[model samples]
Target: MTMAQARGTTDGWPDGTFRNPVLPGFHPDPSVCRVGDDYYLVCSSFEYFPGVPIFHSRDLVHWEQIGNVLDRPGQLTLPPSTASSGGVYAPTLRHHDGRFWLIVTNCADGGGNLLVTAEDPAGPWSDPVRLPGVPGIDPDLTWDDEGDCWCTYAGIEQVRIDPRTGRTIGEPRRLWSGAPGAQAPEAPHLYRVGGYWYLLIAEGGTERGHAVSVARATAPGGPYEPCPANPVLTHRGTNRPIQNTGHADLVEAADGSWWLVLLGVRPGGGTPGWHVLGRETFLAPVTWVDGWPVVGGVEPVMAAPPWPARPTPQPPARDDFDAVGLHPRWVSVRSRPAESWSTTERPGWLTLRARGASMDERDVTFLGRRQQHPSCRVRTLVDPAGGRGGLVVRLDERHHHGVEVGDGEARVLVRIGSVLATVATRAVPAGPVRLRVDVLAPAPGDWHPGKEPDVLRFGVESADGTFDVLAELDGRYLSTEVAGGFTGRVIGMYAATGSVHFDWFDYQPEDGDGDPTPRDGGAI
Candidate 1:
């Protein structure tokens, strides 16, 4: 069944359990805070324009994208030279006094850690207050009982800061490093719980060995005591479906219970499995044992919280391109200039003016959304007569797959590293044509002992509503393991030359039953 159909239904789950990764696909470094009965969450948006996507929920299980924190060009700017995963990093969201505050790191040139505040969570957030004094990524903000603010960052460092002026009140000092000998200690969060100030952090890199450790002290800056059971959460060296679990944030519910929101990946296929959906946000129960927090195991499914589940409606599967502005899910590479894309240029279509010659350039005029599901179908109606453009699934400039419509033909193209090749082509009549791509799960007999993550089938549809598949490529080439990056696959449309108008774009999540067969069959 489609994701929309699966929403709000509890079929086959009679034990009142909910699935993990509440926020799926490419949503990493999740930080959540609860204000009153509402919960707000923000995730790292590396290299994507309109950085830091934020969500709001009442039940914590049902999250809706209210808007992005850095929606204006003034708030975020990524030059064409910005690398694949080199723009915005981890963000910590918190509500203090009468406003919501966010602190994050921008890795782009002339960028550093910054803070923004708003009276409303879904808002016109204030322009960034650049924190030139903060010297690391994943900056976290917390306040002591006396209302003094402190900034904690990836180095496991801390400093007293004046939030209003973005100035450091004192020199930064080192905090407790995570579990002994852990590499790449980062993503630190300082919290004041009960009578002690707890410092939580992620270490051992963000790869397979990622883990979360904690320490506490009676004072914000003091001789802290490490939790006897440190490394509170981790999936390292395990056969579990979820891997690379760490970078967690804690929130206390109004009911006095606590929850942990963290990031993890579901790797598919064989040995040295590859993950294409990027790191996803997962939820787990947190209980205190001997004054130390104990994190529950993360799984594909787990028992529901004490409160009743409230599932929000999923976003529409199809975008008609009639709105005045792009939705929060829509994102572009590097930057999205006003002249580069528009919806009113063609009224009911999205018009994109090409800047780069092809997807090989980082400045390509492309707009896409994350591939949120393991198996899904994406298609777009494009009129190539105006210029050359079509639907593409991109990992980066060097790794992508696309179906190009130009010169009266629809050609399937694949780019892996330095190689870019046309796998198949088919001539089509003029006017607007439908181009489609299907990400299907791997079949049992697909590989002898080592299985592929998935198969991506690229093709076109005829007036009779039949899809003519052109080429099918292994999905591993577009995964994080093979691509050597921190991002996942983003599927959308682009203009390779001149101006191209997309009549509409539709994305639907398919059933994940490991069936490699095509849903529709027709000759090219």
Candidate 2:
């Protein structure tokens, strides 16, 4: 399929005011860079085949997905033993000397730290340049005024590297471990601003205690001093709606203002610790104090966007399967079924040939997109003629819930590790069926400070008939807290026993809101 640019025309929503989670649903460990009046960002994709998802924007408030850096098997390879959160870790995007560079770690099968370069942000990027000795993850690169380049990584370690080859030029030096009490010092970024080198890191794990901290020194490798107030920003121990706030990237806007792009989770009220939408990308303004950067607290909803209006391309609500291949937003767990799926087999239908691998296996036959909202509905029309597989809400291989039609039975099944529970089942006639899943707000709990759990309802229908409710499952089982992964809930179509065909798939938020406005005349 030819590469098409995804654009958003946000002329429908009210001007100026915007929402939090600028990029919602599993868009974690965000890294961003600015060039002239345009802004570009990239996020971690873990076991997802496309690796890093790239976004473009003129104004910081709005963003549209341009393309993925690793779109082919030649660029990245995920082994069968790779865990759901084990393929690609945090990725850093940088624009220097008129070229765009991406550095990431593929944690599967010893696929360590590597680099890929492209002249265009929307890329046909180069193959991986392995950084053999750079240990740990979340690697960042910066150039000094003296023409020296340095790499700072997860263990709070630094080394000089040759940009041409991923070879180290010096010994790995240990830096400040961050504040006294925080744990898991990772996601390190260095910036040279105003004669001072600012170093940023996220610590205290990525759960309730997660936070963003800062330290600065006169040189790249420091005798760094931690900020007087320590953790520059965090939502831990607070009653705020956004939680697990950390893993941030800083960019200077065209208007000379500093903005922060970070990952945060929006927990449902009453559900407390349960969150199904996963860690999302959030935006906030930054203010400087005594040459130190401080992040402005983020809210669930922003009354006004900080930057001028810009155009953003939004993902379509429904996919017709008429294109030559899948949309850019469509992704698969670990290895995608290259020969197991097709769109041209039946013209307008998407055909999925059944593989013996079930949903619990790493090489399952599945195609999915991020579940972007708490209150949303996903439905797909499938022809399961003497076959199986339908719509599935997946957290990982072992933790997933699906409403499948196969083996002459239509059922809703939930699997947690070695245990499998069938929620509901019914007999189905031999033709096509429509499967739908609705995500409802969580019931309030006493321990939860206004957080909500994802309550999922499954149903099925035929031709002109109405949907029949099968079962309701709590979404917390598919959450990061329970499933234990660096990914969010992905809802999509899959087949298991026999070949199945999907006619179309639809997705939309319950609120029925449209795209945000694009910057004036900046649509591409």
Candidate 3:
């Protein structure tokens, strides 16, 4: 039987059990916090606009994207140099003194590290407060029992700081560097558990060698001792299906149990070392063993977690473009999207004013949502209006595949490195056109390392109720491994040169099945 036949269903999601990637797609470097009975999580947005996607969940298994923290241009900016994996880095979310605080590093700007606060995580967050004293990525904020505020950062250092003004009271003191020989010690999180101040950090470069280590001191700042059993959690060098596991946050449930939320990548079928979905949020139970927290191993699907079961809210599978504003899930690149894209100008349609910058530059006229599944279909209706516009499966500026309807013709464009070539083009009977992209799942044992195996099919719907194939491109070119970024594929609408209006966008994904194969090595 075929892989699809063996699964017996296309829905993919398991019943009565949750999967490893609680939050799928490009969601990475998860930072979670619990306020009362509710849990809130945030992830690194990189160059994507409406930066720092925040999610809410009653049960860890199911999550809903509530909002984007940096939705305003004044709040965040992405310069031209802010490459694919360069913008907002690991963000730490914390609740203290009746307010929600988010700290992150914007590598694209000279600001370095910054802080933002909100009364409600789901809305209008305050402008960023530049933390000049904190000079590193993945910054975390903590408070001692005496209300003394401290900033712990990836340098494995700590500094007493004024949270409101982002002023440092003293020089930053270097702390433990993690396990003796571990490399790239980062993602530092401090917790005052019981009688000791526990410091958790991830090392091994956030790749296959990534790992989580722990150390503790009697106080928040001091000479700390490494956990006897260092690297409390890691999947490095193991064939556990989930790799690059690290950058985690710990949360305490109301039931007094501890749970860990982190990031991990799932390789495609047949390709044991290649993954395209990027780093995703994963959950695993924490059991205190000998005064040290031991994070249990995660499986592809968790049959039954230790926590009490609860109902999870379902998210809509498609966007009809009927709303007055952009949905929270829809995002742009480098800068705020509202300045260029609109949903109110045209009722039940999204109007994109074409910007001068092509996909090769910053601030391109593109708005898209993350591609969450390996096998999925994305379709959009567009009216080019004598301009260049259509649907695009974008990995970044230099790597993408799109179907364009403009200049009296419809064409398929693929850009790999410095090569921009048209795979196919055809003169069409001018009218509103429907552009569609279908990403077929890779077959098991078919993947070749350093090459693309997933097939991305491009086509346009005809007036006679038929679809014409424009081109078939290899999907592996967009994979994170080959693309050299910390993001996944994002499929959405695009326009160039003039104005284009999109009637609607529909996205659907097939259930996960098959052993999967890597892509075949080939030149684009």
Candidate that would win on TM-score: 1
TM-score for each prediction?
0.96, 0.93, 0.92
lDDT of each: 0.88, 0.82, 0.82
lDDT of 3 by residue, 1-524 (tens): 22232222224333546656778889999999999878899999998998999999776767788999988878898876677888899999999999999999998877589999999999789998988988888999999999998999987889998989999998999998987777899999999999998999999988899888999989999689999887888898788888899999999987888999999988764454567778998999899977899988777766545555554455566777787777789888786555578787778888888874466666688889998877887788788887888898888888888998887788998988788898899887566788888777765555555435467878897657366777878666777777788888888888786888888888877655431323343333
**Where does candidate 1 have its weakest 10-residue lDDT segment?**
5-14
Which candidate model has the greater lDDT, 1 or 2?
A: 1
Compared with the true structure, the alpha-carbon lDDT of candidate 3 equals 0.82
- In candidate 3 the C-alpha lDDT for residue 276 amounts to 74
lDDT for 366 in candidate 1 is 96
Best by lDDT: 1
* Better model by lDDT: candidate 2 vs candidate 3: 2
Q: Which stretches of candidate 3 lie over 4 Å from their true place?
A: 1-15, 269-272, 306-309, 337-339, 444-453, 463-466, 514-524
What digit string (tens of lDDT, one per residue) describes model 1 on residues 1-524?
A: 33443354533323577677789889999999999888999999999998999998776777889999999898998998899999999999999999999999999967699999999989899998989999979999999989999999987899998888899998999887877788988998888888889898999988899999999999888678999887899899998989999999999988999999999999888879989999999999999888889999898877877876656567898999999899999999989999999899889999999999999998999999999988888988999766899999999988999998988999998999999999899998678999999888765455434667888899998767688889888888999999987788899999999999899999988765366464443221
Q: What TM-score, to 2 decimals, does candidate 2 have?
A: 0.93
Off by over 4 Å in 1: 1-6, 9-15, 443-449, 516-524
